[model samples]
Target: MANSAPASVWRNPIHFLAFGLGSGAVPKAPGTFGTLAAVPFFLLLQNLSDVQYAIMLVVTSLVGIYLCGKTSKDLGVHDHSGIVWDEFVGYWITMWMAPAGWFYIVLGFVLFRLFDILKPWPISWIDKNVHGGFGIMLDDILAGLMSFVVLQALVRFVF
Candidate 1:
């Protein structure tokens, strides 16, 4: 930025992701846009077998923690809204309960965004204070958990 605090924070990856690979940097709700951008990745991850899905989810979360942490450190920001890799992995976590379907995907997306945005109780708690790798990944992980539980309930009762 022209008068942003640190010079280092304005680097390439931070700049790119800060715009959400240019999406967040748009003139609208960048965070929402960033989350929206994670959809296709979710679809790709959704195609795998249950065992593969589980393995991928674990790996994605683990990798996301490190990646988010490193990126935050580099950007001189903590859990910057621009970083949406956590969003990607988190959405994948939400889809873990069932196979890919537009209804489930859309609902899961909405729920995850709600938990992420409204930050109900614990999500709000984490967003307000935590600052680091786990901090960055924790809220989204929780959102995914919330999505998973709700989706599972819906599947068990309705379907």
Candidate 2:
């Protein structure tokens, strides 16, 4: 079940970001909403050069650790379902070096969501055992990377 959004999500700036600019507050499928919210930002980032995009991925992922951790701490929750800055970073990772088109964007979204939701192998293991903000971010990071590999392959071979 989805954890309800804390009141601070609106009042606190950090919490607001952790909650994916309020996208995570939805009653159902907050993660999906959060990922969806990331699409626009991804579109904007597409303008950047590959190196710039990679830098953004690293910076956002690093900031997400603190944002998610601090918000979770403030709310006394461990990786609250409402905290979704990680989703933004994860989606960004999945789109790295992707072709410039809506088709690839949609495909990256689907692939990233699949890897994130399925939690295969080590991702599941890490999600189970890890704790705190880094733990929360790590699993999605893996999901994005796994998605990245597959998306790249599809671009290379099939699409």
Top-TM-score structure, candidate number: 2
Show pairs that collide, candidate 2: none
Collision count of model 1? 3
**For candidate 1, what is the lDDT?**
0.71
TM-score of 2: 0.97
RMSD, every candidate, angstroms = 3.6, 0.9
TM-score of 1: 0.81
lDDT digits (tens) for residues 82-135 of candidate 2? 888988899999999999999999999999999988999899999889988999
- Against the hidden reference, what TM-scores do the models get? 0.81, 0.97
What is each predicted model's overall lDDT from 0 to 1?
A: 0.71, 0.93
Give me the candidate number with maximum lDDT.
Answer: 2
